[model samples]
Target chain A: MGCDIIVEEKHHVASRTKNKYTKNEYTGLPRKTGLALRFTGLWEGRCLRQFRGRRLAWAGLVAGVLLMAAGMARGEFIAVLYKASRICLECIGVG
Target chain B: MAEVGPGGMGRIRRTVQFAALLITNGYWPGLGRIAIYSGPAKGVCVPFLNCYSCPAALFACPLGSLQSMLAAARTLPLYVSGMMLAAGFAVGRLFCGWLCPYGLLQEALALPRARRVRLPRWIRAPKYVLLALVVLLPVVWVSAGAGVPFFCKFICPAGTLEGGLVLALGRPELRVNIGWLFAWKVAVLTLFLALMPFIYRVFCRTACPLGAFYGLFNQVSLWRIERDRSRCRGCGTCVEVCPVGVPVVEKPNHPECIRCLECVKACPYGALAFTMTEVGKQGSGGTPRISNFKVRNGR
Candidate 1:
């Protein structure tokens, strides 16, 4: 009975290892089979495409914050404050 | 979770829009005195277009600030650009749907049950042109003092209605300065107001440079609409319900979609949804994808 239990454990380990290697690292689709052996590149491309928008958004948000900080440091806020506070003739469609 | 219907969502939106209007222009003390709010809040730019010259406006308009910054020093308007980028990247034109006072007014106009027609797709191009040529025109022809804010001076109906009319009514002294330009602006404002009932967001779809600017980020905005193709029957309900005419099933995150969420609520199959994150399991391509695991029974 003990010997049979050991054998079952070994089979389970083998199957897990097989799955780890057979699945694509990114997409988890079946990796390469027959002529489709070049699918590694395709899987990587798909992975990148999936997350591109999210990555770009984060990068843009960071860039915006930094730029805004720089502008504030340069007293652009003061300029905006002065301009916004005053009633401009242009804003009122005058002249 | 109990999902809110289009009616509930619309009421929430109107409430938010009204609250935003009041919060931004709540200073009633100087409402009829020609004395505008000159507080520290005026430094911060509001995402949607609100005329700063209005007596009660407590914050700056981004478009106005952008033009002013550009026309004055001709340097990159880093501050305004940064603010716009942050807002756009975060939520795209969500401001247009839920916050813009003008959008609210347009919706109110649209509610009167006029001849509503789906605007041609080509109508989306003019705002971009206005942004490129008119908004940026002041940068080149900079005058001596504060440079000319071209869009405000010549085009903006909000400036005419909120700022010009209010100030003119309040202060008789300022009305003397009003001439052909004011008349021209009034005509333009009247045209837009008249068209709003029939066409639905006529100014926004065709001429709002601010909307045009924010629309660019719709593809990559953090907040987005996703359609579950697994359940979507392609019944055209979403398309039928969309106020901005976004072909929801075909292109869910179309630039014109203002994220009004009417499509999501109106979809009988509960296929469309608003998602905050677009990272995992979502498609960056125009058509959103569902994972194989998520597609029940290979349907």
Candidate 2:
């Protein structure tokens, strides 16, 4: 049973979908890894290792979207428009 | 990372900067008359420091929007924060190097042959202080029933130049309203103008709250600079070329780096590079090493 589970795990890992760097729709290899590969060619592994925390960037993108939605829902978008459309004399050092 | 030779990279940067300026402030109603754009686009905040009241500005300044929203509703500025975060993470301070019209003006002031003022590292602290005041003063004043965009009124030289000077030139009658406050603002603008040539983006390095905010994301931004320790010789060429005086070899992802790529073009070993993807390259590092990368003069 343990051997069967090991086989299933290996299959699952192998069955992962293709990413941007994948060779083909089904194959696994870099088709377009990063600019580092195109540029230095030698700095490829370091480039990928340096980006180990790229998941943080993705999370930030999602959080930013969510915050924008919340702010718009609360009518902040109109508030921004109302304020931006008019010239506040104080802002220009006149008032 | 194909080395766009010195002239090539500079030409590309200048073109991008000029294009950004035109795109942000392109609302030309007529040649003579000046009018603020109040269209639906004004609701959207552009990533840089273009003033809202500029005759042709199509979008709101994020700093101005944040302060106004905080003062009016006395609540958290979720929208501006999110917008800033998204832009910061996506491109970091690329906007400062390539998009900010104010930065363009400073660059024009910076003559290539002129001597630069070597400011102490402590000079980097004030922008954060200004940012703090920008966020807090609005809430503080609003709670007391005197709502105001504090930084816009007191400190923003961009507003003074783009909004005040431009509007004053177009509307003769508005000149009558100019008082001590206007004079004070002009003085502030003058100080910035005088210092810029000597300091190389002094306003951006020491005063711009927007730059300060975006600087925080330089480390985690989607687009980033990477330095290869194995390849770098610690020659300090990158440090000398950096406009913001970032110690590039020591800290390739420093907060102050504007990513102008001057260092990348200047490096003899080609130790520095920028990447746009997250995928790592795994292989028998192809391409023979070029120990003496030829960096032509004027790089």
Candidate 3:
């Protein structure tokens, strides 16, 4: 009933959805299983469900930073690094 | 993880810098044609504004760099800057929402706080007045022959406070020339640095002119937050987590909101979201109770 209420309320934006997954949508994984996979880091989902908690998000963020640092110090594709920083600075109008 | 693609507006900055390094004597070390002059982008001058004083910044920021440019040229390209001002007037601080590295830095610092500090109703307007003083005042007053860039010299936490000032500090001549306004900027920075761990992005809420500009875009922004009161149990997680003190439940589309989507992330019942009005139609309660976020007297 709650989900149905939400679905009904969301008719405005949902109407815009050109759902490719219509008939035989059952072939797609169930909501629970998809959510579980997302929590397990097999795929990205909503932020609330992403890592189950802040600890894991911290863990992921730290690991990602360390990996980037290691790669950056070695001068691994300096052009790519330069380009990314440039883009980061430039996106706001100047870099 | 939206992997931002290449071949965007960014390529120009990188390409120019790279070409400059190659053509100049520094990087190439005795390459042909040593005289490499790298200045602000002239073709499309922007007056809308940003923290262009950043060392790596390529474009001239309208608010911060305007006096110097006009003083240098005397005859300004009045129409070019007009387009950017039009964009700002139409959309407001949309640039801060979409752009602004300093704003991004505040967001990053705000991330670790366990809870957010909601601003009192009284604090929101100071930023608008600041925008007028910093951006507008200089344009009007500088004609009287003020040598210093009024906004950059007096206020701008970005220019006087950030890494640019730190880098500039290394030169003794620059350090000696630093005045009271620089001290004020440092004091503001010191306060923000002190407050960031406790509250989040307080500067963005209270002081940042760029943020003030961007807040104007909140209602019309393509990416925005929406609340579903039907599902909300009024848990207050969204309010508790918001760094900018946005009253999510009461004013989801409030102009002050950066549209960071932190509230959307905090809503456990999927009551809040960053959306372009996906499902909110036919009797949909977009404002939720949790967004009001009041403390219980019992607690």
User: Which ten residues in a row are the worst by lDDT in model 2 chain A?
Assistant: A24-33
TM-score of 3: 0.55
Interface DockQ per candidate: 0.25, 0.25, 0.03
Q: For candidate 3, write residues B139-222 as lDDT tens digits.
A: 455444642345555556665443335334444444554555456667766777666655555666777665676577555443
Give the alpha carbon lDDT tens digit for every residue of A1-95 in model 2: 99999999987767654253355232233343332343442344554554555768767878887898898898888889899989877888976
Q: Is candidate 1 or candidate 3 better by DockQ?
A: 1
**Distance from true location, Cα of B53 in model 3, Å:** 3.4
Candidate 3 structure quality by residue, lDDT tens digits, A1-95: 99998888798456434332331232221222121221222223334443232333234334434544553354422322232222121111111
Candidate 1 lDDT over B95-207, as tens digits, reads 99888888878887774333136788888998999889655687776667656788888888988888989998888888889899999999999999998877778899999
Q: Where does the lowest 10-residue lDDT sum fall in candidate 3 chain A? A: A86-95
Candidate 2 lDDT by residue in tens digits, B71-109: 887788899889999888876898998889998888878
TM-scores of the candidates are 0.80, 0.79, 0.55
